[model samples]
Target: MQGQNGRGTDMPPAVSVRLEVIKRRSDFLKAARAQRRGMPGFLLQARRRASDEPDPSAIRVGFTCSRKVGNAVTRNRAKRRLRALAREILPQLGRPGWDYVLVGRPGATVTRDFAAMREDLIRALRRIHESPQ
Candidate 1:
């Protein structure tokens, strides 16, 4: 079977990425107050964890979609896309000891082309890292 890139799909890649997700609402709220970068498809919230925080070497991430995004199905779809974007980009680009959040837009998050969204995420991350605190 051919994959999306027209490659064979007999076996999966050997890479195993361990992604740590932020679960508590407090963590999300904390990220909300931190630096944010807006893109065509979504908003990125990121901050470095304090020295006293646990898992200093881990890259943690979170995803959120508000009711304005849509109903339950639409919101879930947006979150899923954000998760995919984070998984693909964060492992390589994310800074250790930082907590990152991906917030979905009303129309853009659900309707935007995925490749464009991927590029937006990459740019957003770069902006977040390069700008002063």
Candidate 2:
């Protein structure tokens, strides 16, 4: 099948990433604070920056897994899973004006189902954006 650019569907979609996903620091602190929300499977935190702030158009995700999750190897595994999940969902679910930080929990997060983790993140973000404080 052909795509918008007349490219083959076998080719990946040209992702339209926004700077809000990548910018590390900025002045939209209120937006970030307002957007911070959490769920059972994961913790979600966000910070908003100025609308005109210059930022790279790529998704920048921060993952944190403490000793509670496991040793180095377990932490790394959990992080990798989170990263994969973020890559799949961020482009579609993430807001262009916020930064997200996902913190990993201990037992459940370490052995939790992979697909469930992805869905949790997506659901969490959707709720955050949908609610107005």
Best by TM-score: 1
Question: TM-score of each candidate?
Answer: 0.87, 0.70
**What is the C-alpha lDDT profile of model 1 across 1-133, one tens digit per residue?**
5744342322234235567999999999999999999998999999999989998989999999999999999999999999998887787678889999999999999999997897788788888999997
Evaluated against the true structure, the overall lDDT of model 1 is: 0.87
**Model 2 residue 98 lDDT?**
58
**Pairing residues by index, what is the TM-score of model 2?**
0.70
- In model 1, the Cα lDDT at residue 36 comes to 95
Instruction: Indicate the TM-score of model 1.
Output: 0.87
lDDT of 2 by residue, 16-122 (tens): 66423333443333334656666666677765545575553434556777798889988898778777767767776775655677777877676888767766876
CA lDDT scores, all candidates in order: 0.87, 0.64
Q: What is the C-alpha RMSD of each candidate to the true structure, in Å?
A: 4.8, 5.9
